[model samples]
Target: MNKEETFIKDLVVLTPDVFEDARGYFFEGYNKNKFSALGIAIDFVQDNQSFSQRGTLRGLHYQNPPYAQTKLVRVLQGEIMDVAVDLRKDSPTYGQHFGIKLTAENKKQLLVPQGFAHGFSVLSETAVVLYKCDQFYNKASEGGIRFDDPTLNIDWGMELKKAIVSEKDLVLPDFANCNSEF
Candidate 1:
C-alpha cells in the first residue's frame, strides 16, 4: 500500500497493491498491522456503506467531539468524486478542502481523520461506497456544511442543477456559518 498526503494535514490518499489474474483481481482492503506500520492506528469500530445513483451528492458531514470519527473510505463499485474539508481549529489547512476521484477500477481510498467533514458525489450510473469509522455514530453530534458552500467552492464534478441532495443537507449551514468545534 502507498500513502499520499493531501493538501490538508492528516488527510491521506491510499493506493493498495492489487493482484490480478485471468479471472479477476484482489487486494487487501485493510490489515491492522500494515495500516499501523503506515502510521494509521485507529481501532475502527463500525463499517458503513451507501449506494447512490449518478448526480447524487451526500455530505460535508462530520460528528462533534466524543463522537468525532476517522474514516477510511473507498468505492466498492462504480465511481465518485469524494471530498474532505479540514475543520481542525489549529491546523494550517483549516477551512481548506480536497477532492479526489475514487473508482472500483483504481481502487484508491481516502483516509479522513477526525476534525474533517466528508462527502461524495456519484459519477457513475450507480455507486457503492464503503467506509470504516473509528467511532460510533451519534445523532446529537451530527453536523454538516452545505456542499455548495461559497467559501469552500467544492466542485462536485456535476452541474448544480443536476445534483440531488437530501433535504437535511440542502439546509445545512455554509462553512462560515458552521459551528465547528474541531
Candidate 2:
C-alpha cells in the first residue's frame, strides 16, 4: 500500500497495489501487519456499508469524544466524492476539509482519524461504500454539521438543489454552530 498525506493532520489516502490478469485482479485491501507498518494500528471493531444513487449526499458527521470513530472508507462499486473535515480544535487544519474521488477502479481508501467529520456524495448511477470503524456506534454520541455549511464552502461537484440529502442531515448545524466536541 502507498500512503499519501492529506492537508489535514493524520488523515491519509492509501492506494493498494493491484495485480491484474486476463480474468480478474487481486489486492490486499487490508492486512494488519501492512497497515501497522504504515503507522495505522487501529483495531476496527465494526464494518459498515451503504448503497446510494447518484446525487445522494450523506454527512459531515462524527461521533462525540469517548465514542469518536476512526474510519477507513472506500468504494466497493461505482464512484463518490468523499470528504473529511478536521474538527480538532487545536489542529492546524481545524475546520478545513479534504475532498477526493474514490472509485472501484482506483481502489483508493481514505483514513479519517477520530477527530474529524466525514461525508460523501455518490457520483455514479449507483455506489456501494464500505468502511471500517475503530469504535462502535452510539446514538447519543452521534453528531453532524450541514453538508453545505457555508463556512466550509465544500464543492460537492453537483448542484445542492439536486442533491438528495436525508432530513436529519438537511437540518444539521452549520460549521460555526456545530458542537464539534473533538
Candidate 3:
C-alpha cells in the first residue's frame, strides 16, 4: 500500500494492493486489521454507495460532534474528484480542504477522519462511490458547506451549468460563515 499527503494535515490517500489476472481483479477493499496496524481502529458502522453521472456534486457534508464521522471512500466503477474539509474550530488546519482523484483503475481510497465534511463530483461518464462511515447519519446534526463556497474555491472540474446538486445543497452556508456545527 502507498500513502499520499494532501494540503490538509491528517487527511491521506491510500493505494491498496490489487490482484489481477486474465479472469478479473480483486483487492482487500477494506481491512480492519490492516488499518489497525496503521493505528486506525475504525469501527465503521455503515457502508454507502452512490451512482452518479458526470458533473454530479454530492456534498461537503458532516454530522456534528457526538455523531461526527470518519470515512474511507473510494470509487468502484468509474472516477470522481473527492474532497474533504476540516471543521474542527480549535485545530491548526481548520477550514482547509483536501482533494484527490479516486478511480476504479487506481484503486485509491481516502481516509477522512472525523471533524471534517466530505464530498465528490463524478469525473467519468458515470461513477459509483463507496464509503464506510464510522457513524450513522443524524439529520439534526447534519451540516454542510456550499459546493461553491468561495473560500473553498474547489474546481469540481465543471462549470455551474454542467454541475448537479439537490435543493438542500443549494442553500448550504458558505465556509466563511459556517457556524459551530461546521
Candidate 4:
C-alpha cells in the first residue's frame, strides 16, 4: 500500500497494492498495523455505504466535536467525484476543498480526517460508495454546508441544476453561516 498526502494536513490518498491474475485481483483494504506505520492510526468503528445514480450529489456533511469522524472513502463500483472541505478553524486551509475522481477501476481511497465536510457526485450510470468512520454517527451532531456554497465553489464534475440532491441537503447552511465546531 502507498500513502500520498494532500495539500491539506491529515488528509491523504491511499492506494493499496493489488495482485491481479487471470482470475481477478485482490488487495488489503485495511490493515491496522500497516496504516499505523504510515502515520494513520485510526480505529474505525462504523462502516457506511450508499448507492446513487448519475447526476446524484450528496453531502458537504460533518459531525460536531463529540461525534466528529474521520472517514476512509472508496468507490466499490462505477465512478464519482469525491470531495472534502477543511472546516478546522485553526488550520491554514480552513474553508478550502479538495476533489478527486474515485472509480472502482482505480481502487483508490481518500482518507478524510475529522474537522472536514465530505460529499460526492456520481459520474457513472450508477455508483456504490463505501466508507469507514472512526466514530459512530450521532444525529444530534449532524451538520453540513450547502453543496453549492459560493465561498467553497466546488466543481462537483456535474451540472448543479441537474444534480439530484436530498431535501435536507438543499437546505443546508452556506459556508459563512455554518456553525462548525471544529
For all candidates in order, the CA lDDT equals 0.94, 0.95, 0.86, 0.96
Write model 3 residue lDDT over 54-119, tens digit each, in one string. Answer: 889998788887888888998989999998888988878887788888899999999998889899
* TM-score for candidate 1, residues paired by index: 0.98
Q: Which scores greater on TM-score, model 2 or model 3?
A: 2
Query: lDDT per residue, candidate 1, 40-149, as tens digits?
Result: 89899999999999999999899999899999999999999999999998999889889999999999999999999999999999999999999999999999999999
Candidate 2: regions farther than 4 A off:
none
Candidate 4 clash pair list: none
Model 4 misplaced regions, further than 4 Å: none
> By TM-score, how accurate is candidate 2?
0.98
Predicted candidate 2 versus true structure: per-residue lDDT over 1-182, tens digit per residue: 99999877799999999999998999998888999999989899999999999999999899998999999999999999999999999998888999999999999999999999999999999999999999999999999999989889999887889999999998999999988787
Candidate 4, residue 56: CA error in Å?
Answer: 0.5
Sort the predicted structures by TM-score, highest score first.
Answer: 4, 2, 1, 3
TM-score of each: 0.98, 0.98, 0.94, 0.99
After best superposition, candidate 4 residue 24: deviation in angstroms? 0.8
Expressed as tens digits, the lDDT of each residue in 61-118 for candidate 4 is 9999899999999999999999999999999999899999999999999999999999
